[model samples]
Target chain A: MPRTALILFAHGARDPEWAEPMRRVCAAVREQAPELRVELAFLESIKPDLRACVESLIAECWERILVVPMFIARGGHLKRDVPLLLEELRQRHPQTCFELAPAIGEAEPIVQAMARHALALASR
Target chain B: MPRTALILFAHGARDPEWAEPMRRVCAAVREQAPELRVELAFLESIKPDLRACVESLIAECWERILVVPMFIARGGHLKRDVPLLLEELRQRHPQTCFELAPAIGEAEPIVQAMARHALALASR
Candidate 1:
């Protein structure tokens, strides 16, 4: 069976702490799926841009790669930059299967979770 | 008791559909807290900027307001822009208490939900 990897893609910031939540999510996924390799990549102001991260994974012999955008919404970055970068990677490595998941915010449980958190915070 | 309101604050996009997820989250919050007034506010490219949303809520006699940053991480926008905006709002409405919650991504449950979704997608 070919190895599979997961990349939590996020919008980086100048603040080093900006990536903490993404790292936490990546850690959680890593804990849940020990068999699958999980990593985090950023769009800017951070190390290991999407291309570099994917290239590293490809070098590691990951045949199947899933990119989960850590963004809260399907903004221009998701609609334009992500596809453009992915297409380039696809052309570079046609044999690898790369799948893009919906923005994390678009997921029902994620949305509901935010709602619950908001309620709890407001109540407090 | 003074009225309470929740504002789901987000970074808006030029694409109308980009706000769908934020709307879903606002809907979920509204459903979960029927008694509390809930509204959606955007940083740009959408209606009801944070100031306007908070101003409207204040006009409605909501003395207690919670601004939930729907952003995924603590970027410059969250760390700098949000605080500046909130401080201005606070100065404008001295009686109202404007509480700013941590970025939704910083919430543990939200992070976990993203991790779960990522695992499910990677497995699929």
Candidate 2:
């Protein structure tokens, strides 16, 4: 059976603090899907760009990979940069199957998570 | 005459990288509201918590203050802890008026921002 992998992509931050939440979110996803291999990548200002991340998965011989954008909205990065990158990767790695998930901000879980955060604040 | 102040609140991150975006967002808001005094605060994992941020505004004698959560969602922090803090501050500083705005994630500008980021990514 081919191995499945998940890549959590975030906007690269020069400050480093913004990336922590992406780790937390990836951890949560891993906890939910222990069998799936998950990794993190940044668009800029960080190492392991999306292309490298995807190439690494291909080298690992993973037959399927899910790329999840940790961004909140479908901004320019998602609409333009990400798709362009994916297309480039797709052309380069025709054997690998890559599925792109919607940005995390559009996810229902985030709304629930935000509500939970708000409730926690209210309680304190 | 009453003065207006904008308080940009973010989830406190021990990592520090996450906070940079909050600062950027605050800067953008300040640019838009140059006449308004703007400040930054966190819910946890940082100094000058929300209460201190608000108290300082009161000390400055601002007649009205707007607190905007830089959080991505309406999580527990927004629903619970923030309101509790505001209530406590209200009780302590009855002379100062406060209005809490919705979390930044819900704002249309953010959606537009994300889309711009995505487009940028795609173009590259």
Candidate 3:
């Protein structure tokens, strides 16, 4: 059993198709690292909201979980909403370690990849 | 002067720092392809709205522009708001060619990079 889980947290949209890309990212992450339990959680309309995702993982005896925000950058939601949710989850599950990872988009490699994609697209 | 320009379109936020990553991508694209004019345009709460950016580029005689959305997925903002804005711009500048590139996040390599980042973060 995997002791650690990686949760991709994103701002969900009203349109169902909006989650398609995030789902693809989830699948890709799972394929790359099958050792870690991976799941997708949404901040809004999409199912398996953060709390629910954490609960399910905790039930599976996953003691440590890292939440990686998939936002393009740090914004009001990250500044205001996320901390509260994480704090509440911590209170709800004192035994489980629910850690907040850095904003995924802020990663240097990720930024470089986006830049490359933009440049390539522009060229095309 | 570059005949083609690339506009990285993003959903802006109230926080000034929210656009940092998008700005970095813009700068990286500029560095990668100095021949193609690259810029950042925001949908809200940021400077250089799409119209103003497009207008300035037109003034500079840049004839072709490719707008690449920095959004993670195709949502209501993209489906409803962007097309209308692009259409308005096209009408305002019939001579200019304003093309929409696929969403940057939906790009295959970008998705793979994100997956790799997630796994890397999970391991740490």
Candidate 4:
């Protein structure tokens, strides 16, 4: 059986506080799926860029890796940069399978949840 | 009683399709809360920047406006840029009150939703 890992990739920010929400999501995922190894990575201004994070997982003999973009939209970072990074990762780690998920904002449940949050705030 | 509006403020991208998810969220909010007026605004690379959106609302005689940053985290843009924008808006429209909500990612429900989405994708 191959070991699988999930990486919550996000757009990094200069303020350290910026990573809090993604960290919360990562923690929640870890709590839900204890068997799988989970990690966080960033595009810029943060530690463990995607390449480095993937390399670390590859070294750990993880056979399958899922990269989930923790973004509100599939902007330039997701559409142009992420795919390019994934292509490079594929070339480097041919044996390890890398799968990219759609941006979290694109998920229906997430969108609905956001709408609920907005409604709650608006009502207050 | 003064009319209230909800502004879904997001970081716009060069690619127009990137706005789809935000649009969906906006539509869902509209569907759920038909009485409240909702609008979408961007930080950059798109039309109707935050200033313009708020100005339009002020002109429309909206008394209270809620600006929700549809970001995954409280990055530099949120911590520094957003406040500055809000301050300027406040100075210009003292009659119209403005309130800022936590980024969508900070909301517990939104975070849990992202985690669930990640788990589903990782399992597949």
lDDT of 1 by residue, A1-124 (tens): 5578999998898888999999998889888888889999999999889999999999988998889999888888888889988998999999998988888899898888888888888787
What lDDT score belongs to each candidate, Candidate 1 first? 0.88, 0.66, 0.86, 0.90
Candidate 1 chain A — worst ten consecutive residues by lDDT sum? Answer: A1-10
Those runs of model 4 whose alpha carbons end farther than 4 Å from true positions after fitting are none
Q: Tens-digit lDDT track for model 3 on B1-124?
A: 2378888999898888889999888888888887778889999999989888888888998888889999888887788788898999899888888898767778899889999998887887
DockQ agreement of candidate 4 with the native complex:
0.86
Which of the two, 2 or 3, has more DockQ?
3
Better candidate by DockQ, 1 or 2:
1
DockQ, all candidates in order: 0.85, 0.06, 0.87, 0.86
- Measured against the true chain A, the candidates' chain A TM-scores are 0.94, 0.87, 0.92, 0.94
TM-score of chain B of 2: 0.86
Candidate 2, B1-124: lDDT as tens digits: 4577777677675655545455555555555546667788887787678888888888889877778786644655677788998888888888887878876555544434433333333223
List model 4 lDDT by residue over B42-89, tens digit each: 999888999999988888999999999998877778888889889988
Worst 10 residues of 4 chain B by lDDT: B72-81
Residues A1-124, model 2: lDDT tens digits = 4467778788766656545555555565555556667888998877789889888889889887778787644556777788888888888888887778776655544433433333333223
What's the interface RMS deviation of candidate 3?
A: 0.9
Superposed by TM-score, candidate 1 places the C-alpha of residue B46 at a distance from the truth, in angstroms, of 0.6
By lDDT, the better pick of 2 and 4 is: 4
Q: Could you tell me the TM-score of candidate 1? A: 0.95
Query: Where is model 4 chain A poorest over a 10-residue stretch in terms of lDDT?
Result: A73-82
Using lDDT, give the best candidate's number: 4
DockQ score of the complex predicted as candidate 2: 0.06
Ranking by lDDT: 4, 1, 3, 2
Per-residue CA lDDT of model 1 for B46-92, tens digit only, reads 99899988888888888899888988887788878889988988898
